[model samples]
Target chain A: MTALSSPATPWKPSVLRLGLHRAALEIKLFNRDVLSLVLVLFFPILMLSLFGTVFGDEPVFGADPSGQGGITPAHYYLPGMLALSTILSGFQNLSSYVATERFNGTVKRLAGTPLPAASYFLGKTGQTLYLIVAQTALLLLAARFLFNVPMPDEPGQWALVAGLMVLSTAAWATVAIAFTALPKSAQSASTLAVLPVLLLSFTSGVYFPFSQLPDWLQSVTNFFPLRWTAGAFRSVFLPPQFAAAEPGGSYGVGTAFVVLAVWVVAGAVLARLAFKWPPQK
Target chain B: MRTPAPGSAADAITVRDLRKTYRLPKGGTLAAVDGLDLAIGAGETYALLGPNGAGKSTTIEILEGHRRADSGDIRVLGTPPWKAAPAFRARIGIVLQEATDSGELRVSEALGSLARCFPAPRPVAEVIAAVGLDGKESVRISTLSGGQRRRLDVALGIIGNPEVLFLDEPTTGFDPAARRQFWELIRSLGEGGTTIVLTTHYLDEAEQLADRIGVINQGRLIAEGTPADIGGPELRIPRVRWRDAAGHHEETTASPAALIRDISDGGRREPLDLAVVRPSLEDIYLQLIDSNRQEPALTGARP
Candidate 1:
């Protein structure tokens, strides 16, 4: 008979260590999936560069003709682009990847392992963080060099941007995990993620200034995290005079932070309640 | 780390009154497993044979800790598998029916990464060689053939050095030569003292590898015994045949030797074209399943 033999040496595993190993593999796979990488990392940059060139030299119709045009449409569009990229990294990409893993029995195999479910969750979310950081860096560098958008000059502004990036990514990633339960297959999951994110982007000022939209429509975006993400980025990146383009015309930095914090707390709770480790049949 | 002392429990697996039911789309529930009982000794190979929707996979999944039973007690490796304790998982392995769908990883990379999950994993190179994928170690999983992917799944299952291995239809995609090779691998694993619980439709596979066979139908264990005894004492029945001037003649009897002698009783030294035949395992298995399905007593016994 085969006895239940233990290992000769004792080794204890923590969530962090196990998650790091899983995250390492996940990051490697992400690096190999050229299509996913291009979508998450380069799609936003490509769109920003294309649109930046188209609008950089043209003057906005509403701005004073004699004011030396303090900010071009490209400068106005950079914050929104960053916000869209964050959504793509955290929500769209993550939901599709998770759904595929579940559909293909990868999630089932992992669940059978000795690793904790928390480790798997943390590992995938960590990969999301890595992607978002890379996407943000590439986008910012592109905007600075290709469009001559100024870098955040103050230390406090840099801190705010860093904080916003972390909070928004974490919040959207949690919601993405929760939303994955709704899709029955990987293909449907990808399509599901795209439609809502695209719609949210249009309404959340990802392609245009929020103040330019109607009053009722502006009030509608107040409920979504994407709007706050865009607002937060604009507060950090755009010139102070550009505050007139945002709702309330003062760059409500405090509201941006508070609304995002609410999303983080609420999203974490919802995801915890809705997420299923093995998925349903 | 704690080691289980030798001979603490002779049985590696024990189950009592297991039951599971799934709700159908039309709001009625179908019982997938009902009142099933099984006990397999340590170091013994048990093959669970059943037809489709016969609850074979559900029973194995319950034992593998991948699914929960509606009501039952199942002890594997001295603990209820449903607890899913990591310590318990480290001592058990499973090869699921579907091949693992890891497309992007190379063979070596997949093994290396999964090895970290266990406290003491077998060497990656050794496991690769064991499953006959030595030269294909660098090949991407997407590029592997169906048979090769199944081998990788087996490799992952054994890499943890588990005592109890549960294989759910592990040879579905294997070609003839590959199937024979896999049987050799399984025999070696059993010889090394792993308690194997297997589910397959191949009766020959069961006859070749299992110490005992359990045939289930409609959530009930219809028959259980050694391969020879599972078909009942009628297994000894043999058909005696011969060709004569009149025609060919055949007769089934429990004593084929006596019947043959009687046929040559007229002082004839030999009988022309004489032969005796015994029923194969496949024939007996089909009869058992067919008889069980025809029994009206087995219906409406869901729980």
Candidate 2:
């Protein structure tokens, strides 16, 4: 008969060790999935290229001729593509991974371990950040080399945009985590998560200016995170005078940042309350 | 940090009135594990023997700290498993029935990642060798065969040098040869002083691996003991077959040896295709299950 043996030493596990271990697993899985890599990197680039060619030489959203004439189609599409990349990093990636892991009992297996829930999320965030950075680099290179788009003159504006991008992606990733927790299966998660992103991208002006949309559509689109993200990105890249070209001139960067922050906190709370480590029952 | 002195012999695992119930999506509660009490002693390899929907898996899950119980006073290694403290988890390992879909990660890579969770995990190469995946360490998980994947599952379960290992239907889909190999692996682990808790529907598996066996039916433990003790020695009726003078076969006996002696009439003649057969573990299990089914409300009956 085996006796109940106590630990010979006090048990103390580092959260950093747990996070790093999970991150390594996540990165390995992401790299091995060739299809997912291609979609994340090139999907936005393809969308931008198609829209730029189709809408060439047109007066987009009725901006002043002086400011509008100087901007190329690529320049107009670049910010939207960046916003698209952020959405993919958060909603598409997080939801699918969570759903698949849950379906296959990987999460159940992990729940038996000593690792904490926070460490798992930290690892997922690390993977999301890596994908977003890769997507950003690919979009920028394609914009500069293939379309001859002008680079931002002020490095400070670029820094601010980069910071906001990280914040927004983290916020959206939280929302994805919360949403995925409610799904019963991987199939449901993929459909539920991907459809909303696709719909929002279309209505929130990823392919065309929001001003082209009618009043009712604009009001509905404004309630979503995609519109604010696109508007914020545009504010950083476009000149001050070009604000007249956009629906809500100047982008309301402050309000956009605040709303995204609120979503992040709310999403985190929801995830904590509802997320199942190995699922219930 | 010094190890605590070994406590009472009754302290391996102690449960008093353990119960678990869950709410169904359509709105009623399902009692996965009803009020149950069980205890395993030190150095014991105990098997929870039952068929599907017998609540064996639910009981094991609660003990493994993966699920919470609705009502119970349970102590595993002197701590409530569902509390899920790092200290409590460190001494236990679990091998779930399903293989993890880790995708494209090499066998060694997955084990290496899991090793970080423990304070003193076994060497990665040693664990790989123990599970019989020695030369296939570099092979990705996606390419492994079903049996090989199951071996990998065992490898991960023991990498932490856990004192107690829970194996939930470990050989569900294994071939005969693979099952034998797994049995040998389990034997060696048990010989090394690790207490093992296994669940299986295979009667032969329980007979072979368990020092003590427990059979759960519905949401309760119906019978428990060493295999021999489970079906009493006197209850092991043998089959006796012999031809009569008129060429009609006859067979009846509690002791076939005695019956054969009486049939021979104290003098040797020609053998008549006679045979003596002892009751097997499967026969005993079926008899117990049948009796349990016959009396549905029999409470507190222990084999």
Best by lDDT: 1
Give me the runs in candidate 1 sitting further than 4 Å from their true place: A1-12, A58-62, A278-280, B1-8, B242-250, B265-273, B298-303
Model 1 chain B: worst 10 consecutive residues (lDDT sum): B1-10
Model 2 earns a TM-score of: 0.92
Local accuracy of candidate 1 as per-residue lDDT tens digits, B144-226: 99988998999989888889999999899779899888888888889889999999999989998888888888888887777
Candidate 1: RMSD to truth: 4.3
Q: Which clashing pairs does model 1 show?
A: none
| DockQ versus reference, model 1 | 0.52
Q: Ten consecutive residues with minimal summed lDDT in candidate 1 chain A? A: A1-10
Give one digit per residue, the lDDT tens place, for model 2 in B111-208.
98888888899999999999899899899988998899999999989998898899999998899999999999999998887888999989999999
Ten contiguous residues with the weakest lDDT in model 2 chain B = B1-10
For model 2 the local lDDT of residue A88 reads: 90
